[model samples]
Target chain A: MLVLKNIGVTFDGGTSIGSTILNGINLRVCGGEFVIIIGGNGAGKTTLFNVISGLLRPTTGQVMLDGKDMAKIPAHERSQYVARVVQNTMAGTMCNLTIFENLAFAFTRGKRRKLLPYSTSARRKIFAEKLESLGIGLEKRMNATVASLSGGQRQAIGLLMSVLAPSKILLLDEITAALDPKISDSVMALANKIIVAEGRTTLMITHNMAHATAYGDRMLLLANSHFQREFSGPEKEALTPSELAKVFGEV
Target chain B: MNTLEIVSGVEIGLIYGIAAIGICLTFRLIDFPDMTCDGSFVLGAAISGILIKSGCNPWLALCAATLGGALAGLATGIIHSFFKISNLLSGILTAFMLYSINLRVMGGVPNIPLIGAATIFSGASAIAVLTCTCLTVVAIFTYLLATDFGLALRSVGQSKGVSTNYGVNIRLANAVALMLSNALIGLSGAIFNQHQCFADISQGVGTLVIGLAAVMIGEKLFPCWSYLLIVPACVVGSIVYRIFIGFALHSEILGLKTQDLNLITGLLIIIAMAAPKFRRRSC
Candidate 1:
């Protein structure tokens, strides 16, 4: 389980040399539950993600993963328990590296990077099979560099990479923002499939209302430096894109 | 030019090729502008010279020089990552500090003569010795860049965000890369000092430029995308560059003298860098 209690972030800039970006946020995500957070510009959605990923330390309160306080842990160490996929397609994957190489890197995530060759026959077979599941024929092009792939293809590969390693929590930070609507739908579907198959606790933040309502077991609206509303079960199932949009504008 | 001049050029090229490979690692692979190359080169020479003069085994002295270079790289990495200094400035600062360190290593002397002291080249032919050493270093690095750690290293250069998310310690990777890069440069410096029978503190001047020229020339000439080919290309480019220099020095017809080497090298790098742009514009 991943839990955040009384988390707050204040940027060191502005009239008073500080401005609050996030405040008094409390969240608890159970194992295998998918949570979606929706927010407009400057609503501190990314900051909240950063705080959970240990990229930013909260001004107050605690981030607990499996009942262990992780506020002091660095991002790289926190990654052992949490896997994140960012919005920038190029940010989540190494473009210059080959598809096989990129997958190989994710395959050994959180593990010691030994001096041994990363791609053995056995590992290569596994990577190819994983790519094959994407239905994009990336398996046949394992030797091709990621830079040569399209944006949607790269993001798909990025999503695959995050789930390749075993982790308790997966944070998808607007990962489909750069892709077209159709591509984003497919990527989201793949995400849902992976989350169900692996039963991982996931937190996905998005600006797309449709995506926000379509995939999550629980949905949270973040505005004015805190969660404005939380919907789940039948309440979340009854949420429509227009109603969510109206609520977003009202806040 | 006589056959002897060509032979000497090849020897110098092979020795300096190791430094060029190091340059490729920092500048090309890791995207770090490592100015530490200049001082580390001299550091290598000084360490090897001091040890060899003190009657230490020449091979052991070479190893020490390599480690000394790695330390210089580590210093830069620490300043950059730990202290939050910019990469370029961190390298410049380390290079500045290494000047005094190199002088101190040579016991306050700016130059040391290795003449009459048994060196690695005591009996081995310069060509045979350098070729063997260069091949060995190249093979080892090729194997290194093909490993899991190599992937992590390259990923850190490509995207720090993804590297962190994947559990890579960016600072540690940068440090390791710089250490490996400077170690190779140090090896070349030690070889150069032994080959020339002297270690001059000023010999490190323009070392970075020379290495850059070799790396650029190799990539421009061979134009391969794979690191596997790019690694060897560094050596080939160094050899080719040295041959050109050899020709320029002997070309009285062109009114070129040995002192004009640096001037021509700077111009050559500019032309090489701009040529691709010109080609693309024309196309």
Candidate 2:
């Protein structure tokens, strides 16, 4: 449901200093497809997500979602179609607000914000039901400040928040990288469950190769700012971590 | 304190609290230590005073003051966002320009009086603190923070990158957040002018410091789970801080003259700023 055509982004440091982050990169994801992207630092994985989310304008490219060109759309306007979870735990949620309040904000995404009085009763009920489905016991603490939450709990909330809006696309940028392994497993499991249940298209970036192979339906390795290899279906299932690393020359 | 004194204290406290909440929103959420509060507060008073003197409705005057403060904040946001200026410097620049703007608004005078004017709090007593005007503003601010747009504003303050990823336009959100913050401060200024019967340009000189003090005190007192509680805590804290200052002024043993208000305020800020450091070390 998403396609990027020759997306290129360049940053100018000074008159004599300039760098290209992404060079004519092309990618596509169909509906209900979960794509795992693995890359080293500065491989333009995040930049690719940023371009798709309308946070950065490609110097020369077109981003189309479900066949609609989003080149002219602003970031806030694109929220109705794309939802993103960032690398920082604090970035995924408002630390100062309660879980319910953050969820309320997500519920009204892409709408004009106004200063109206809020009644937490209905919001609490909805959040509680959603939290119960995750079996995380977060429903009981709807009024708790997000800052007080553990990293895993926060990530779960972040994942739930991304899918709360009726958006067609979800971007996960190292979301579980900050959590402990056990917590990360639960979160990944939850992510797989939600994506499959909702039939939403997802693009997840991870540094861990095990997670890349274990989670998504397809995996692609990014090298030197370009897609170097693609693995999927039985081919992905048969590939081992060591063999995958050998192909990328890290073994 | 007598009922009359308590009523007066509460009214004054509520006004300062409103301004303090605005300061807290920008400081804590947006991570912008905005000094525009000082100029915006005075600008609010000046604009409201001028409009009231021209026979405008008190409500309309208040609206003009809020818009004036919003414009000042917008100017600061534009400077910071477009020019990549430091947040503090941008606030300082806007505040410095507002001094002259406020002067012009008051026709070169430093103060304006509203001796016989009708204010929203004209007939409000201790029991009637939640007047129609107060209720309306509270409702409006509460709604603004609860809405999706408000969430985007909070997200921007939390993390610029996350906000962008959420499809929230950081520039627009920052601009609107600053405008709303300064507008609230302006509303307080309009209320204060009517209550005090005069608006002095010097009244806002230490407004930012006062706001910081209120926020610090509120956070210490409430320490609640919900973000919305910060709003009322700031209101209460402002009044409590003022009451503390009033007590110090009235105590014969302290020998603190009323004119030494600025000195006391400065000292209070020093104590407040140091208290956090001490707590961190202790922990």
Candidate 3:
């Protein structure tokens, strides 16, 4: 579960050449609830994620992780409870390192990293098995540099990496936007499968109306600096893909 | 080259090889454009030379120099991260400040001579000492890079946004990488001053260039070395670079001399850089 109370972010103290991006916003995500969000440009969707993840401090609000105030915690510290997947393929993995090394990094996330071996032969076997399940043939190429992988493969790994270690929350931000249509479907399918199987509270942002209406137990439309509409339970399941697309409207 | 020339080349090369490994940590591993190695190198030599002159054990002086250099790197990191200074400017400012601090550390002297003192290489053969020291440094460096912390640092360099998403503190990783890099350079400075039995303030001016050249040479020689073997490649590159330099200086038919050292080094780096591009084109 997660709670954000009256979050606001303003640049330059909002006095001289200043602007406010996120203002008076509140959101609550229940346990095991898959929440889908749709927002236009500068709707403060990413900023909301940033505030929750402790990367950006709100000007007049606090973030609560399971009712615990996270205003003082740094981004790195917040990662203990929250896992994030980004849209950028390059940003999700280290190109210079092997797939095993990246998984090792994910496994040790939010934990103290001692000067001990991060991956052994046994660990490699487990990692290989996990990669094999991705159906990308990444298992045999455990030692191969991640740079050599395609964008879709990288995002699949990124998604898996976000779930590698135990956590309560998962954030997916336009993760499949860059992939080809065929690849995007499978990656999103895999992501959905993992989120539901783990029964984790998940928040995902996407521009696809079909996905918003087709997946998740709830939907939130963020517009004009705050959450404008919310649907859940029966109302959420009743919404159609065409109705979701109409919500975006003509400029 | 004669035995003395070859011996001197290996000894100096080993010392610089250690420094090159340090440079590789920032430039290659973390992809950080760190320019603080110049000041740290001289600071290492100056601090170690001062301590050895005051009857301290050579090894202890070297350790102190390493810590001191780390502190210097920390300052650069603070300026860059907290003050939001550009990374290049941060290193340049710290390096400028360290120039004066190095002189002050040596009692406002421009140089210190450590002749007839108990140094790390006082009784050991030049070849043996250099070989042992290079191996030890490479071992420690490789081990560090293979750890989770090292992976985090590399990730930070590779992509800050991704590292953030993964919960890595970008600034902390940068600071730690810079500290480790400069510390190794500091130790190299210690060995250098001991081998030459002197420390001069101006000696650090061209140090970064040499370290960069060594990294380039190493990568060129072994393009496919993984992160583990890459450490040894850097060390080997430093020695091979030094040997190349020594040979170029000693050549008679080509009419090369010591004064042409800088020209040759610059040309070698250019050639190494261009070789990869040419290979790709040919392929």
Candidate 4:
């Protein structure tokens, strides 16, 4: 379970030079629930995610993961329970490393890295199987540097790396915003499949109404640093893109 | 150049290769233009030379020199990571501070002649020592790069965001890399002092240029190779660079002198940098 209670984030140290980015934002996500959050520009959606993931500490609030207070945790330390994938194609992965190298790194996420063998045959086999399961034939090019891959492929690898972590919650920040429409839909499908299969709590931010309405078990409309509306179960399942577009219009 | 001159070039080149590997670790892998190598190199020589002169074991002197270099690297890492200073400026600051420390290490003397002193390879043939040491160091470095710790170091270099997101201790990785790199460089300085039987505070001048030249030459020579192969490739590149200088020094045709060493190195670097562009144009 992930919970955000009365979260508020203000830029510029909230002192002489400051602007409130998030205000009294409260949210809770249970295991096996995929929450899709949509907002217009300057909606504080990203800041909310950052606060939840411990990248930015909120001025007033508490972040709880599995009923434990996570407000004091640092970003890297919080990664033990929370994994995040950012929007930039280049942000979530290392370009100088090979696919296998990247996977090997992800395999040790939130864990102490030792002088142990990085390319053990068993670990290699497991990574290979994971890649093969993607059905993208990436297993054949494990040795190729991430710099040589396409944007879609890079994003795929980013998602793959995030899921492989021993995380209780997955936070995605516009994961497909950089890809083409076709690739974006495919990635969405892959993410949905993985989230359901893993039964992990997920929070995904998207700008596209179709994506917001098409996937996830719940939908949230955020505006002016607050949750304006929420739909779940039958309402979320019956939500339409036109209804989401109307919400955006009102915002 | 005669065979003896060529052999001398190879010997010195291999020694420089070790230092160049250290430079490569930061400049290429971690994207840090670490100027700490300049002062740390001389620091190593000063410490090693003084230790040997005090009748300490030669092996112990070398180890102490390596540790001194690691300390220099750690200082730079601390300033860069903790103070939020730019990486280049932090290295420069550390290098500047090390000069005073280095002079003190050598008893306030700018030069220390280690003649008749026990050295790490005092009884061995110079060429044999160079060959054996180069092979072992290169092998160990290559193996290190193939480990999990190495991957984390490289990851931080590639993307700090990704590294942090995945729980990689960025500061720790940076410090570890700089320590290892400077340790190798200090080893080079120690070995060079032993081989030449002298240590001078000014010996580290233009050290960065030489290492940069070697790394560029190595990358030019072998653009694609495994991690292990790439390391030895750097060593070979360093040797070839020294050979070019040797040929220029012994020139019977160009009327070149030893004093023109810097000019020739600069020219070679220019050529190396432009080679790929010229190749693409021709194609």
Please give the distance, in angstroms, between residue B261's alpha carbon in candidate 2 and its true position after superposition.
Answer: 1.4
- Those runs of model 3 whose alpha carbons end farther than 4 Å from true positions after fitting are A11-19, B278-283
Candidate 3 residue A235 Cα shift, in angstroms, is: 2.9
What range of 10 consecutive residues in model 1 chain B has the weakest lDDT sum? B221-230
Task: Give candidate 2 regions above 4 Å deviation.
Answer: A13-20, A114-122, B1-11, B54-60, B111-136, B146-149
TM-score of each predicted structure versus truth: 0.97, 0.87, 0.95, 0.96
Q: Write the per-residue lDDT of candidate 1 for residues A1-251, one digit (tens) a residue.
A: 99999998888834577899999999999988999998899999999989989898888889999999997789999998999888999888999888988999998898999998887999888988888888888899999999999999999999999989998899999988999999988888888888888798999999888888778898999999999999985787788989989988999
DockQ for all models, in order?
A: 0.82, 0.43, 0.69, 0.79
Task: Give residue B37's lDDT in candidate 1 (0 to 100).
Answer: 95
The TM-score ranking, best first, is 1, 4, 3, 2
Candidate 4 per-residue C-alpha lDDT over A175-235 given as tens digits, one digit per residue, 9 for 90 to 100: 9999999999988888888888899789999987788888888888888878988888578
Candidate lDDT values, in order: 0.91, 0.81, 0.86, 0.87
Q: Candidate 3 lDDT (Cα, whole model)?
A: 0.86
lDDT of 3 at A22: 80
Compared with the true structure, what per-residue lDDT tens digits does model 2 show for residues A76-95?
Answer: 78988998888788788877
At residue B99, give the lDDT of candidate 3. Answer: 91
Q: CAPRI band of model 4?
A: medium
TM-score pick, better of 1 and 4: 1
The alpha-carbon lDDT assigned to residue A135 of candidate 3 equals: 84
